[model samples]
Target: MTLEKKQPTPTAKPTADDEIDLIALAKTLWDGRRKIMFYLLAGAILGLVFALASPKEYTANTTMIPQTGSSVASKLGGLSSLASLAGVNMSNVGDKESLPPTIYPQIIQSIPFQVELMNTPFKCPDVDQPVSLYDYYIDYKKAGVLENVKKYTLGLPGLLLGVLKGEQEEGALLDSTLASSLISLTEDQDKVVKILNEQISLEINDKEGYISLSSRFNDALLAAQVTRKTQSMLQDYISRYKLDKANEQLKFIEARYAEKKAEFELIQNELAIFRDRNKYITTATASTQLEQLQTQYNLAYTIYSDWAKQLEQAQVQVKENTPFLTIIEPVRVPLEKSKPNRPLILIIWIFLGGIIGTGTVFGQELYNSVKERWSE
Candidate 1:
């Protein structure tokens, strides 16, 4: 009867052997302190070398506000209905023809644009000469000893691949006018283009209708000059594109005006000769002939006058459609370098080194633990 009342015993809690010991982990890290310090010191030294070896870059920036044709809508108002009848929508057509500020950056970064920019002449104060970007990159940009070491060490694989590919012949430099139609590039030109792309930057603010163009180079003066040139080129290109239709219309009008003027003059001269020849003649036939010549001259003169007015209007339209780039902030030579922040670079290196060292320590501990378990 008493055995029925017996109680079940509780299992004992797991002992400390199954739990982690923070103290022991700390001791292990302490034992590896020297190794960590050595690794960290090595990393810091490497960072210092890299920071010192890095080339200095100066940046030049310019801001431009795009002035679109304001009177375009009014100018096309009379033709709006005609356009609609012809199945062409004229609503907001002016806005459509004018490029948005957002596209400015893309245009600058385009291959043809970059190619033309590379060939643009820039005066470099450091080199004491005016040179194209291609020439400047190849001939004037001297690498430091540390940079040479990195090229052979860190960039060894790329160097070997380039060597295997063999050297490529330089292509003829393209002019702005010719470069617009270029579809391809030579190996040397491609290399220069890649570098040019990296050096140039464009920022567009559509809401404000402004664009900021910047160029970075080792020489301050060159950076400013290149940025200025790029801005000018972009303005010219956009203006030409916007006014292209207007210009063609103007040319046609001028030609027609010339033709009409000659016809009007000839008709007037024929009428005058008829009057002079028929002076004091009262015959019905002579009067009819003179009247017909006079009527022809009047028609020709009216047509010529209309064409002359049209020619003047076309000229005005071309001028009105021409886009203007208002320079909000002009490019200026930078007095200070834009890149190579030595202190920041050094700090980044130190932090990376610490991480590597910590990882190494934990990896060693893990290896030791696995080995001990295997022995057991």
Candidate 2:
């Protein structure tokens, strides 16, 4: 009875390998503190240099709302008003656009669109005279220390390849108008386009149904000018596209109307003359001839009237399809630069350097551990 009343002894908890490994890792990092510090310091120094050497860039933005056409319900309401002016029932005509407002961003990305924008003259901070994007970037552009470093380091292979190939003759410059239609581009022109594309961007907000055009450049004035020009060109392009079909229809109808009216007038004059000449003549042939002239005149008059009405409708259609771009936020020259976030860049570099240094330390430790085990 006395032995059964004795309390049972408690078992001791087993030690975890994870806790030991964590302590060992902490010791290893502490031992390699000097190496890690060296890397961190180097990273900070490089970051500082890059931050100082980085070129300042200004960001210019413009937002606009595209008014394609009136709503279908409201469109019919205005048709009556338009019909009174156009002299046709425009109610049956449906609103149409070759490219909708949502496709506007794609239009801006087009090669022809970018090429046109590149050639447009803008004021650059470095130059006294206004220069095109191509001229400024290629001829008058100055490379910063950071740019040179990137060129010599990451882009070294490409640079070597270009050098080995040697310089080639420049391509011929074609007519700007012809180039747009043909989409012809020289090597240098293509290069400039790539650069320009990087500088400009278009963002469309579907929910709000608005567009934002942005341009980033070294010069504040140039950035704003490019953004404004891009917006204007896009709007103009869309308007012209929408008007193309309507305008063509109007021209065709107008031409036919003019032709029919001329025929109608000639027939009317002939009828008048025939009536005057055949007056008091009681012959079956004379009566038949007068009836034929009267019939010809009536047919021509009907055709001419119908064409004239169509001509009016075509004109109204053109006006209806004309797109209106309302400026939600107008482009403005940036007072301060938008890029070269120095502090952020420095932090990133330091963090990257620390990671590399830690990796190096762990790598060395692993190699030594393996070598010692193999030797044993």
Candidate 3:
């Protein structure tokens, strides 16, 4: 039996079915392309519309490096004393007590600083045409959010009105609204002169030990005024803190001076008595006693003079109110607007639109697939 080697069974060539259905996917996309394009065009149009309608905003930033030595340093200086009292490790306590750079930033953003700004002349240049900074913040010109809220509530029926009357809410609301309006109106005039005090921004970079102050208004001059006034306000705050120390020193000196003056007056009286009692005008013993009295008087007079000088110095220093804060850079009026970044806004809108459009396309495709299978 001459059997030729059996040929291996022939395998069939793979059909396109074994591969991914890329053409079907392409067709699906092609069918949905009009809808996708429409949505993209709509998004672009809306973005353009917003860009046109948005108000132009300008930003002015001033940077300041914090001083190396501050009040906190002085407060934490005598750590050894605290450590001894607490019976803890001086190093740990001292380290713990040391004020970090972050604290200054927090101070910059604190309510005290905000209240101080409120009392000063920090105007917002963005919105104040004739309105004050406070008014601009509250959006008082045309149906502000608060006004809208009130109008909406008032439009609602009986229950709200009853509640308002029952709680004496109407009076409180009127007072609040009136106060708000007054704050908006008079913010410019009540500056302790004439500048609004509600539009200062304090931005602190703790890592860099820098602070940036900013303000806004319709008038460039007003913005500049606010910036300068804020610095002055900070100076005043520092002065107030040291005012007590100056007063204390003054009081101490004054009290001692008064005592010395009284003693000197008594010595004078004693000298006069001695003169009156003694009949002899040229007695050696009398002369010697007079010299002793003169010496005592001179000593008292010297003490009084020293105390007077100290009191004078304290008063002068107190009046000066200098705390030695260094201004790294002064604030200047910003020429350019800093808000409503058009390119950034466009990018964000485009990105969000693309995501939404893609998701919509996928969702529709899934729904169509399920529907076709159900019909089949």
Candidate 4:
């Protein structure tokens, strides 16, 4: 009993089933090496084809600081009344009444803005003169070899549907005529609008109060040109919104001034004609008529003069309200292509292939294991 008690208890070692078979795992991978290599080879070939086939693009961007009328008013702190005249609220220095920079992105995204951009003329290849994007897309552009292949292969379903349903005709989609109150977009126009939306972008930094407007295109010159155009349009739109109320007031004043001028002229002419006709007619009727005409003339003159002054002030207000979108970094032709990172694409495809191949090998292993157990 003493001898038996002196013997040490045996420690249980890990079972084969519980332990990771690293050597077996390596062997499994090694066995599927050919399959993995095939996938890798296929991936590399596809990546090379895609990289070569992809079109090149350039990005052009302009950074701007939105200097509103309020900014100007802040600089002229001495003139308290000047701020009010300039449509700047002294209490709130940011000119909150006007459209904020956040909404500027939406302005760029608007259908009207896209349509206007598409209609703009630019120099094109093989064309002697400038041509609009709409005309170029519809009339001049012919699909390339790769594009045709894609159209027939990847886009074959849509093509078949178009043939069966009758392809929608592409033509002038916008009506600038006064007769049409509603703005409608046809398929062709919608396609272009979508492209425009993708090509153009506006990023605003609220804290710093700055904006970045950018455009991308296949042509470097076109990318820069479009970016410049986009900047101009954005500035114009924001300025228009900023001074909208001031401009309306100016118009009202203008109309009133015109009417008052006409009335004043008529009254003056009547007074002159009456004086000329009755040069020496001295009677109660004549005296009363003269007095009344004189009164009318004075009243008209005063009103007309007041309106004239208001008209001038309103014009000043409109001018004062105009904002400056100070360009921080002007757009320039991009020296490098922005899209189709070939090496990255190739690496990604190769990595994806490796993953899929490893998964397939493991899956086959799992299926065989399950089948063996079922048969047993």
lDDT on C-alpha atoms for all candidate structures: 0.77, 0.79, 0.58, 0.78
Off by over 4 Å in 2: 1-16, 70-98, 166-181, 251-310, 316-323
TM-score of 2: 0.73
In order of appearance, the predictions have TM-scores of 0.71, 0.73, 0.54, 0.70
If both were scored by TM-score, which would come out higher, candidate 3 or candidate 4? 4
| Winning model by lDDT | 2
Candidate 4 local Cα displacement, residue 261, angstroms: 17
Candidate 3 lDDT over residue span 267-325, tens digit each: 98998898899857688888899999888777666655655665676578568744434
Q: Candidate 4 — number of clashing residue pairs? A: 0
Clash-forming residue pairs, model 4: none
For model 4, state the Cα shift of residue 203 in Å: 0.5
Residue 136 of model 2 has an lDDT of 83
Sorting all predicted structures by lDDT, with the top scorer first, yields 2, 4, 1, 3
Residue-by-residue lDDT tens digits, candidate 1, 1-376: 5668666554332334334466667877898898889888988998898898888899999988887654444554455454354344546445434666777778888887888888877776566767888777778777677768888999999999989987655434666678777676776678788888889989878787778889998778888888889988898778877688567656755776787788879988898888888788789999889888887777677667766666677688776744478898989989999989999888889888888888899899999999999999
**Model 1: lowest-lDDT 10 consecutive positions:** 11-20
Cα lDDT of model 4 by residue, 1-376, tens digit:
3655576545433445335477678889999999888888888888888787777789998999977544322433443353244343445332335566778889999989888988999886666789887777777777666778988999999989988998554434544573277667777788788878888898988888889998888888888988999899988888777677567656755775787799889999999999999999779999899999998898777767766766676677777745468899999989999987989888888888888888888889889999999999
Candidate 4 Cα outliers beyond 4 Å, as residue runs? 1-12, 15-20, 71-96, 142-158, 167-179, 251-313, 319-323
Is 1 or 2 the stronger prediction by TM-score? Answer: 2
- Name model 1 segments beyond 4 Å from true: 1-20, 70-73, 82-96, 144-150, 153-158, 168-184, 249-311, 319-323
